[model samples]
Target: MKLRELALISSGINERRNPQGTIYYIGASDFVAPSLLNKLIKPSIMPSEKLEKHFLTKQDVIVLGKGHNGFVGHTIVDDSKPMVASSSFMVLRDFHVKVLPKYIAWYINLESTQQELRSYSRGTALPSINRTILGDLEIKIPPLKIQKQIIEIDELKKQESKLTTQLDQLKTIQLELLLKNKIKNYEQ
Candidate 1:
């Protein structure tokens, strides 16, 4: 099934910052690869009154619409606070009953799909992925049970990667400490 048939695809908001703004603005910088948000830095503030319509909801899929490095997609799992994506993103919402937002996000983040999206990008300096290209892209819709299974597996892989990184860091620290002790004993 084509993506457009599965969900509504629309461009994000284009607005300037307001110091006293109430809503959080999510830009390309706030997003990390493989469907993660970098929450270390606070998002920019944007006024809420005029931009209420652009507020993001839970399960909304956000896709990078403009960039030289190709597009990245992620699902909005949290909607406890008011937040909106910037102009560089395309928001996918109101999904069909057969589809899951995370499933679509996972599909979009696939390496092969990234390459395909890059091919559709226009312009030489800063390639951009527009709504039309995104809408026409084909999507595979499996059973809901399978979709849930895929999402669960992806989460497990991510956890494994995180732990492996930590283990490597610990090993490096242990080796450094061992070397230091050996040098001290030799000197003594």
Candidate 2:
């Protein structure tokens, strides 16, 4: 099914104005973090009250509407705090029951999908991805139960990977300490 069928896709802040209220402004450059927007050093501002509607919420997805050189089609999910997205992104929310936000995010950022989206990118100065192009994408969304299962498994894998890395570091430290102790005894 097309992405539009699974979620409410809309452009973010497209107008130029100064900060009027307390809000976070996220631009294309802020998307330097891939996959998920965990650390956003986005500038804080006081925007118009109306712009509150564009504030990102949990499970919201953001797609870079412009820029290339591995920037276009950059998709990230906002499972974090609410923040305003810049005009450079297409914000997707109100996901259908069948779709998982992270799943869609990961799928969009896939090298193959990014390749296709990049192909549609236009402009000589800066390549971009149009909303229509993104909406027309047919993505396979599994049942909710399956979606949950997939996400859960993926989470476990990530945790395992992290733990493995930490363990490796600890092992290295242990070896270093063992060698140091042996050298001290030999010196004694």
Candidate 3:
């Protein structure tokens, strides 16, 4: 079945605000983490109406709220507490019983989906995606087991990357010690 056939989200642009207490912002710097979901700012206070309306949770997918043109998908699977996002971001609540949010988010991040999103962008000066259009975008769904397997493989890759970094550091130290010994020999 198609992706739109499975998921749900705000029908259109639902511009709202956090309850008036203290507003926290997530800047561009927060998006650099290696995890599938890398940038989430916690707001101290939010409009009770908005808070009740737009609260985020693990497995919820969020898109950039403002500024950046094409950053449209990240799964929030870390924090369990209440946090509000900027108006520029749109959250995709995964209600698809058979589809995994991690897989859906990863699919959106793929080069193919990015190209589709680029075509759907609106606004003259600043580009942004309309929630309605996003909701309607076509996605191809695979079985849930396959989705979980993809996530497992991705995790394995992350572990491999960590080990590679450690290995590289050890090699660097070894080379440094060898060079030091050669220098000492020349002096002798």
Predictions in order: lDDT: 0.88, 0.74, 0.65
Model 2, range 39-154, lDDT digits (tens) per residue? Answer: 73644666677877887876778888777554343334443545777888898889898788878876787688888887877887988777888998889888878878877776
Task: Please provide TM-scores, in order, for all candidate models, with all chains considered together.
Answer: 0.92, 0.72, 0.70
Task: Give the top-scoring candidate (TM-score).
Answer: 1
Give the range of the ten consecutive residues with the poorest summed lDDT in model 2: 70-79
Name every residue pair that clashes in candidate 2: 20-46, 21-46, 21-47, 22-46
**Please, what are the lDDT tens digits per residue for candidate 1 over residues 28-108?**
888665556776645467565767888999999999988876688879988877889899999999999999999999999
* Candidates sorted on lDDT, descending: 1, 2, 3
TM-score of 1: 0.92
lDDT of candidate model 1 versus the reference: 0.88
Tens digit per residue, CA lDDT, model 3, 1-188 = 55556666652134334545454433334455433434354453544564455666777776663444465577776655555555566667855798888877777777788777777777757866766667767877778888899888977986899899999999999999999999999999
lDDT of 1 at 51: 77
Mark the regions of model 2 whose C-alpha exceeds 4 Å error after superposition: 15-21, 35-43, 69-82, 156-188
- In model 3, the Cα lDDT at residue 9 comes to 65
Which consecutive 10 residues in model 1 have the weakest lDDT in total? 39-48
